[model samples]
Target: MPPVQTVATIRRITPVGAYHHLVLDAPGVTGVRPGHFGALAIGGRDASTLLRRAFSIHRADPGTGTLEFVFAEAGRGTRALAAHRPGDTVDLIAPLGTPFPLPDGPVGAVLVAGGYGSAPMFALAEEILGRGGRVAFVLGAATEDRLFGVERAEALAEHVYVVTDDGSAGRRGRVTDVLPEAVTVTGATEVHSCGPMGMLKAVTEIATAAGAASHTAVEEAMACGIGICMSCVLPVTGPDGVTHFLRSCTSGPVFDGTSVRWDDAGTLPDDLEGAAAMTPKASHR
Candidate 1:
């Protein structure tokens, strides 16, 4: 289904670092999953950049035809989006990418995020909570200011652990330092994550060591939000050990960490909370 501007009204606009959430109306985003995303053509080709900037759906409210995004004011494209007004027309490409897989039975699930990576994890938390599956979240930030949306995540998880390099918040170290103990205490059997390469690696390592299933949501500098452009390819190691770059735009923003090679993290990232949030962790499956 094509995306349309139902109302395109800003619900809340706050400075998350430099970016803001337009939290507007987008129809046909109900099917969007936790790891999925959408592309916005807010200002059109008037600026030096022609194409649209991609943001993970922070949320998609089917009842209201509303969608939310956590975006950073990185460059020209996003700046254009920030300038958009209420009832403005912003084209959206939504329900893109597959959602994180749901673990069968009562599996302990852990979510780890760094910076804005918390976007998708929030949605995953809601899924786990809805299923009566317990979840533990580990969020890392360089400093207190780098963190956004911890309270939002707390609403979904059993416990929320914050680790800041500056020691202003919960733990005074990397998010990994809080993982082993938290997972053990929470009895986590599966892990979901979205963040920097290092944090993703740490989560993968912890899950591997703990014998838990691990999935990751990765970001790439994208030209096209859809899979048409092979630019956001992620290198993967197949069963035969053949290496190939998979398109993140189409193949997935969410993939088994074991399946995809955690190539160096992207220089730029995408907005994800609602997209990460929509990841279809079923209600009564």
Candidate 2:
């Protein structure tokens, strides 16, 4: 949001399990909100991965102009991030997308994250707690090895729940297995979830039935990261009677779960209606 600053270099890189945490010299752009993301341009100029990779702002330092980006080490793009040492300048188009709005109530929030989804929610947890709200984090992974940032999340939230499918960690089941317990024990009256499509769906059902407000963060293979390219279209019901396809980039990584057409995850139908998309041009201005 500040005047165009030079590309901030990576000050440090630390590997945390399956994800890498990068500290960049992003000063004026540090006061970013939760759910808003930035674009990090890495790799050589000739590399096929020229465009910036969209990363959720995990931590920010407005004073120092530094940022912490947490990303999974899944492919060449991320591997490029992992390979960065100190003193490397990475171009970033930051502070993009709308933020998650904090709902008011005698509200207790339960954040359910599958894996790296914890990065954004952990940042959110601190804000919620600081505002006198409460949170219980329910984390899930396939096994103990797949679990990441347990200690930090536990520290951020008042309470924590870990669920692993292979039984290698807290409980031998899906993350949903711990929801009822989390709600009952922590008295978390609202829910926010980000993870695999299945887990999000399950949480949606649970929260819907319990009469709890719920939000979901959707994941996809993004091209522009901004909404210029329509590669990330999703189906949604609009204000009018017709349902439509929307852009995932600018409209959301976060959306009201009930409003999202979950059944259309990987394969959005071509003719879906109410297809308004909030491109970066719209969100930034």
Candidate 3:
């Protein structure tokens, strides 16, 4: 579905350590899929900042016309968002991009997330459970405070495993360290992951090796969430086995793990169709 551009009212804003969990009353917005994101207009139309910050839909309840986003105050735009109060009006273009595909039959699934990337997994877990599939979670962060949605994961998932770099949480290692055990114990048949590209890559490899299909949500920097700017292009493989650069905002923020060219994620590959044009022609003959 095309995005809905409208003014939304801030219903609540709660601080979660380095990040803030925000809920908006978006009347006309609906059909938000599990992996969809929103492009939020920050500082209003008069502000100096021109680009709208994009965030994954942490949760969206179509029945109530409410959408939630979790974000860290990383810069001016986000800091402006952090300053919002209840009843504040903000512009939003939402329910954008492709969504995660549901499995055809009931299957055990392991949901993995890193840092604030955990934003979208709770809803995904709920979808899985609603489909009669069991869901397990493995969340990791640099430290305890950076972890988001721990309590929700524990309550919603069949089982929850956490890992923190500083050893402040469940296990003192990377998600990769515990992924094998999580899959084994839960009898997971599929994996869904989101977070840093490095973490996604690791999960993809592990899941594939374990004979499970993997789907992942990418966190690329998108200047325009509507795909007008070609800023968030990433290399992805097509069904014909051709490598093509596609926009994450439109083609995907979510894709099959094995379809992405992991090694060339942030950079264009040497043999890419238009890669040569990136280099200027020689001035002298």
Query: On residues 121-206, what C-alpha lDDT tens digit does candidate 1 reach at each position?
Result: 77777777778788888888888877778887677665889999989877899988988887887888888888776677778888
Model 3, backbone clash pairs (residues 3+ apart or across chains), number: 0
Best TM-score among the predictions, by candidate number: 3
lDDT, candidate 2, at 187: 73
lDDT of 2 by residue, 5-63 (tens): 34888898987776788899977585587777778777857778876788777888777
State every prediction's TM-score relative to the real structure.
0.85, 0.89, 0.96
lDDT for each residue of candidate 3 in 175-240, tens digit (9 for 90 to 100): 999999888987998999999998999999999999998899999999989989999999998888
Question: lDDT score, residue 201, model 1?
Answer: 75
RMSD of 3: 1.4
Q: Relative to the unseen true structure, what is the C-alpha lDDT of residue 128 in candidate 2, on a scale of 0 to 100?
A: 80
Evaluated against the true structure, the overall lDDT of model 1 is 0.74
Best by lDDT: 3
**All candidates: CA RMSD (Å):** 10.5, 6.3, 1.4
As a TM-score, model 2 comes out at 0.89
lDDT of 3: 0.91
